[model samples]
Target: MKILFALISTVLAGGVRYIFEVANGLKDKGHDVKIVALAGDHSWFKNLRAEVIYKPLNLNTFSSIVYAFYKFYRYVTLRSAKRNPYDTFLLISSKLGVRPDIIIELAELIRSFDSDVTVATYYLTAFSVWFSQNKNPFYLMQDFPELVEGNEGKLGLNMFYHSLKLPFSFITVSSYAKQLIVENNPTAKVTIAHPGVDLNIFRPRKANSQNQKYYGNIKGV
Candidate 1:
């Protein structure tokens, strides 16, 4: 199957790492996988199998010009600079030749890719995927974004909560995550797909003497 994973950017983060793992695994299984994002940076992991599409903003375009002004206003008005919005920072960076596109244009770009399955890695991209395609896109719920925002008054909190209400398959990496989604939208079709571990890299360390003694007394090990 042709699979597309949509994310805000390929910046270093736990959620971004999970998306990369999923894309690489899907590619290894002989499926065509592509990562579509607003921008990509080589600060963290790199992709060898899946195609990485980095659609950075083109400032010369009319849409980008308008977006720049809008972002500027948001940056000035926002109480905290940290929450000034990512697109605003992207404008400041202004790296050339990345072929960045606006979020509004994502629907057409995603439709053109003709992917059989689309996975949205965040609430923002979930809306983008929904606008691009009415069905078949999976919302990979990593966590309750509102809690991370730490403020119910934040616009992001509302948007993140509303995204769950959309008619799309919800895929959570753990049962706890699925519970969070169901709590938000009781009618959500949720599924649990646990993440894989690399045994070569991660293994339980031999229990130390204290741990062994405790376990031995408790279970006669």
Candidate 2:
């Protein structure tokens, strides 16, 4: 199955690395994995088997302007074209070739790729899923979309931004993210997909006398 991991995350951030790990793991299973980066930053995905889709303008701002214009043009054509907006920061950083925007753009490029599962994260990616011709849209809510501002009033407006139009079910990485989402949207159907740390890399240290002696000799000599 073709899996498109729409990434709208910064390089070196945990999110980007997670995408790479998942993509690679999928590829190892002989599945096709493609990365949709709203902003460009090819270096991070260098070793991954996934293909990165890059867009020129930022997904956040460019998408907003596009959404605005799309809203304006909707009545003209008598067609309903609801625009999907992403974060402002992702848009601006896209110019600098940010990885997050690249992921957002990848989701929009849905029409060109045949995908069974479209794991969408960020608002822009969710919009891409909405654009899909026949793909299962899955929203990955990593954090409280509204609590981002730390103000209830702004939270309401931000929620008004796009929460009502949120796609299929949501899979969050943390209780905090899921908690905030559930609070704002009690009826919102969201599932928690707890984030994990690689045991070999993040496990507690175990010191042995022999290893310690080697380290001590290496440090001294």
Candidate 3:
């Protein structure tokens, strides 16, 4: 089967690592897997088996300039109020579907690729997948973003919470995550696909000189 995973950015994060590992594993299993992202730092990950496509948002467009000014105004206001300005505009824009330029750019990128299934790796990407001309959209929910600590305010939390209600099959890492999704949106169809460890990289091994130098005095070596 042909599969595509959509990511907001390929930054150095555990969730992003899991997505890459899953894509690589799927490719090894004879499936055509591709990863699409708005931006990426490819140097962080090496020896990737699947294709990664980066389609960054056009910030030079007239609409984007207007959006940037609006964001700047909001940033100033939030900073004056001593609140986190980051993610505020993006969360609201995504919830209200007001940023046509960003949505359209992302949608066009997804439509450019043909895939039997397209998976959203984050809530923002979920919105993009919903608007895209893609088939079999699935949301891989790593956790409940709304419940995450350090969110600016209730408004931000609400936006994250409401995003979960979008119509898409959900795949999560743990049963607890699935429970959270079902409890919040009872209509949501969720499946638990636990993350796999690469035995080749992570397995029982004896302590070498380097390990002994770091933990030679520890109780368990």
* Residue 97 displacement in candidate 3 (angstroms): 16
Per-model TM-score, in order, reads 0.71, 0.60, 0.71
Worst window of 10 by summed lDDT in candidate 2: 95-104
Model 3 scores what on Cα lDDT? 0.75
Which stretches of candidate 3 lie above 4 Å from their native place? 61-103, 146-153, 204-221
Full-model lDDT for every candidate:
0.73, 0.62, 0.75
Instruction: Write candidate 2's Cα lDDT for 22-124 as tens digits.
Output: 7788899999888775444557555777777755544466556755775678757877643223333444334443334333355457666778888776655
For model 1 the local lDDT of residue 110 reads: 69
Residue range 1-221, candidate 3, lDDT tens digits: 99999886677888899998889889999999998876656568898899888774555476466656766776687754322222333455556645435455667788888899999887667778888959999999995654442443455456566668888899999988888788778999998989988899999898699777668668454
Lowest lDDT 10-mer window, candidate 1? 93-102
Clash totals in order: 3, 15, 0
Give me the runs in candidate 2 sitting further than 4 Å from their true place: 58-108, 145-147, 150-161, 184-189, 206-221
Give the deviation of candidate 1 from the true structure as CA RMSD.
8.1
Best-to-worst order by lDDT is: 3, 1, 2
Candidate 1: misplaced stretches above 4 Å? 60-102, 146-153, 205-221
